[model samples]
Target: MKSIKFTVILIFMMSLTTFHAQEVVVVDSTGVAQENNEVLTTSIVKDTIKVPFKRFKAEGVTAVVGDYVVLDSDIDKSYLELQQQGIGVEDITRCQLLGKLLEDKLYAHHAKQDSIVVSEAEITSQVDQQIQYMVSELGSEDKVAKYYRKDNIAELKTELYTVNRTLKLASEMQRAVIEKVEVTPEETSQFFYSIPEEDRPVFSAEVEVAQIVIEPEVNEEARQGVIERLNSIREDIVDNGSSFATKAVLYSKDGTAQKGGLIEGIQRNSPLAKEFKDQAFSLLEGEVSEPFETEFGFHILTVDKIRGQEVDVRHIILFPELSQDVIDAARAEIDDLREKIVNGEITFEEAAKKYSDETETKNNGGQLVNPVTGDTRFDLTKMDPTLSAQVYNLENGEVSKVYNDRDYTGKSKFKILTVTNKYDEHKADYAKDYEKIKALALKEKQIREIEIWQDKKIKETYVNVNEDYLDCDFSSNWIKK
Candidate 1:
């Protein structure tokens, strides 16, 4: 996955369109106005302009918008970066890119004018999250530092802080401009009807699935053993001067272990377990805590840094390894429940609500929700790998046998999956695809609002583009020389 900074830049570039055709003008030293066909230099009075003739070699400026300036080399660098990312470098693409950068600068300029302030704590948190993501992708902090030619992850974060802040400010400004945009049902219906029949989209097969999850219960002895192991690791770090990150990578069972157990930008009021949150927030900088237990497992952590109510920390988590007997017990329990469900002794919904260990699904009577759509239905291909494989051959209203699987936290669990509903591949339907069509309409409205905002900002901001780029169509009036 691309880093957050790159993702923001891509969004800006992809959201813009070319402007309509317009006249272009160029002025020369002789005070003669001519059609814009090539680059021209305008002479300035020697006494009025301060030129660093001795200490500087000047390059041409590609664009100037108010106090913001885009050099020729900046545009060249952006084009090269796009090419590296396998994006097209056609003339229209470059024009669109230039327009996006110009608009971004205007958004930042206006944000400053409005006295919009982002806290240092927020920026630091963002930097930490981005660094964690980068470390995860590149396999290690060492690898990430090498990739960026930095001495360490801290250096990389410092380098990216300004870029991230600018992106964040621009994004906030964009949201302020369009946060009130909404599409009503009537608007959605009208937009759907406006699409020609031949141009309507087709959808793939979809399914609605649900499950009852049963996590294996670790015995007291096993739990104590995990705690003891974490205690030993903590001792090693405290007394032996051993690297916390190295120990975490070697011993931690959490998903973040690959990134040296770093959890970035965690707030005091975050959705962590109360026990875990209290323990983390109470630690002094660089102080390691004693082993503590939460729902997931035993953990020993040290606070790397703290900013106000937020913290950056590294931890080693050791989950009790479930014994074979525990696994068999969970499997047997799920199997008995399945039998009861199949024999009509109890409904699956009732079993899920009464016995399933998955809090989110149990409360919903085992109904799986699609996070992206906030619906129970999902494309078969998009379903969980373990659930989809078992449900692929099952018909609607059929239940699968108890199967061992892992949940999002990577804990082993036994589950009985049911396919509640299924739909074959079909073309878009007004009644069936109302949510999808409505989302599209909402996006279209948002784009229109953004375009209007851009046009107003373009006219208000002082902008000037080089004659070479002035000939290209642009979405904004950037040639206000």
Candidate 2:
């Protein structure tokens, strides 16, 4: 997994597709910390040292954006981070690197001027999470400290905290700039017409699908067995002094199990299931909860630490098994529901409202909301293969055969799909594709706003690019020559 800082940088980079770190000590690919040299040695894995660290470095300043100093090594560090993320930087020139860093600092600098404050708690939580991830990947806390060449984890955390905080400020500032910018209906129509007839974008076929799902029912025996297993695991950890992390690695079914079930930065208002938050916040540090059930499965959680409204925790989840007979029964149930709709005995919407087991869509007549656009339309070309295969050939109002599928947790279920709406491939139309056109217009407007902001800020702010980068082409006026 990439570090939190890399994730932050990646997000910030995406925001600047039309528009677009720190330093101190250097960590080599051999996992050794060394002093600055005239020429840095190359290490294929050196990029894995993901944190932007600062020790007293003799590296020259590459540029100055507002109050932030961009060091020459900072560009190298960003390159290494990109390399570690498996992103090819062979074509990414040093000037481009400096330009991105300059843009980021300007945002962060002005964010401070505008009194935008990133929560210390949030930064601390992220740093801790990053540490935990590195520890999990590198195999130990001592190894993580060594890799980053820090005296201890505290020093590493402090440095990472500063870097992450600034990156976050840049992100927050970008959001603040464009969050309220929206295109009016007239603007959408104008954007649609502005594109020449020959240059208009052709949209792919799309579908709005609805589903009625029936999850296999686990017997009471299986349910109790899972809960009891979790209880036994909890007992061993509490009474036998066994390692919670080891047990999680051995037995947890959750995706975080490899990280010893560690979940960091879980706040009270975090978008987790209610049952989970209730169980998580109820425990004090080092206190293990008794086995409890959530939408995922039965879990026994241990709170590692708590900071104000946030908690870092670990959990082991055990899902109850469904008997083959029970699975068959669910398949039959959905099949019968499909028949009812097919025979016109009951409408798909009515059957979905009355019988569908999927919570997210059941109340909405089983309409699947496109996770990307928060709308019902899904472009088949961009849809997930499994979903696209199911709905690709279905006509409007046509029902699909009952399909066996597994939810995110790998729990077996059966569902019947129906196409609620279908749009054939067509050229952009003001009346037919208003939403898509509106989105494009709004994005163009946001890009314009950012460009204007960047131009104005560069003039007002103190920016000085080193002479080496004076010839490089940048999107904004960073070189005040």
Candidate 3:
């Protein structure tokens, strides 16, 4: 048999706690030996000597769980792949690897016994995403192919499909084990109090700022030009068998272009613009949408697949190019509004309500919310680069000078920011940091629940590890002889 290597690593990250495990299996090629028997032909002329033959010696199993056997070469291959991905092998003990392998086998065994099924489309999509991620990380598809010893992306996808499907099933099983876990308010509070004072995390200096953003309006000609370009691209895709994904990589302005314009696992009821969502969900699989306008820009999308309410799609987005005159007009308007606010002719909130083009913030009087914490507070260091630089020295209630910046979608806008509130760095407190503490507590509880489930499953499953790995330090029980 030809030797092959495989490696698997599962990582879980939580605040103050993380788990990392790696499994490697290396298989050795089978070897055949032949022995020839020589008889004393001079002494026995009538007798013929019979020779016995020996069969090839097969490679030893690296790990075993029930009917599953992990070969050594698979382990070695896994380690090599992990090294290519920049994961260090020096710290991972052989026993740890063996334990992880046993755990994976156990999960796979149980998954099969439970009749857990993963769809082919899901596996294909996940493989594509994994390939895209590796390509991006390794700098190019050719590099990825070389690293994986594959001829191309298609061969790599075929190789990884089974692995991706197994991992998905394991993840689903883990979620099932922990889905019903809940942390009560008392438990959360207690978990918070258990942290020693000196060990408590320190909060960073934070600021709450508000803004009135005014996007420069493109001229009719510019808008029509963008729309026509998108239409032509769409036509090329439909008529010429041109790859929408390849075109998206070349032409899409969005950050996901590196991923072939794929936006994975977006819910149908997501907070995306209504027009965009409607058009996105209305397309059939492999169907491309015509040019459609949203708050961001004109977009053309092809639905790759849909699972329930979640959709995966590739899109090409084009934004209308604005001229200096259009931008100057927006700047002048924002400057006028800022002057009115500074002169007390209109309150900052009132001006924002009346003129801000951004609907999410305008209705709320332009108050900025931290997407992470879902609050109107942000660590000054965490603020948008442009906004932070503009408001760095501005005192509370001070209005910044008008400045041009791009919004989340990379659309140019002019804005005047005001630092409404600032909080000095301090130690975490039960009152101010309740939400943060509760989230940490919930994560801890989930981790604990998963651990408990894992322990129980290990006891119920058949696990066996080679004696060679017995002396290595292992994090789990995989040596049940």
Most lDDT-accurate candidate: 2
lDDT of 3 by residue, 1-481 (tens): 0111121224232100111122221111111112332111111112221332233223578677765677654444444445655666655544444555565566667777787876565566556666666766779988776665567767666667766555556665656666788888898789878888888878889898899999888789888999999999999999999999999999998887877898776665567788878877899999999898887788999999888877888899989887889988998899889998999899888888999998889988899989878988888877778667888899998999887777666778888889888888999888987777787787677766656666777788776667766654455556643
Ten consecutive residues with minimal summed lDDT in candidate 2? 18-27
Error of 2 at 397 (Å): 3.3
lDDT of each: 0.71, 0.77, 0.69
Residues 1-481 of candidate 2 have per-residue lDDT tens digits of 1112232344455333311122122221212355553333222222233223444434687788878988876766766666655577755666666677787788899999999977676666566667766877789978888777778887787777777777778878989988989888888777778788888888998989999989998889899899889989999999999999999999999788888998887888878888889988999899999998887788889999998887889999889977888988888888888888999999999999999989899999999999988889999899999999998888888999988887767898899999999898999887888788788788777767777787888899999888867877666778775
lDDT of 1 by residue, 1-481 (tens): 1112332345445322111001111100111112332222222232122221221213467788766676654444454445544565543245555666777677767777777776555666556666666666779988877765568767677756765555556667877887899999999999888878887878889998889999888789888898889889988999999989999999988777886888777787677888878878999998999999887778999998897777888989887877889988998999899999999899778899999999999988899999878988888777767657888998876779878787656778889988888889988899998988888788778767777787788788778888768765555567753
- Give the Å shift of residue 171 in candidate 2: 1.4
TM-score, model 2 to reference: 0.77
* Model with the higher lDDT, candidate 2 or 3: 2
Candidate 3 has a TM-score of 0.68
TM-score of 1: 0.74
The count of residue-pair clashes in candidate 3 stands at: 18
RMSD of each: 10.6, 7.3, 12.2
Task: Pull out the clashing pairs in model 1.
Answer: 18-474, 19-474, 19-475
For residue 292, what is the lDDT in candidate 3? Answer: 89
Estimated TM-score for each candidate: 0.74, 0.77, 0.68
- Which predicted model would earn the best TM-score? 2
lDDT of 1 at 272: 81
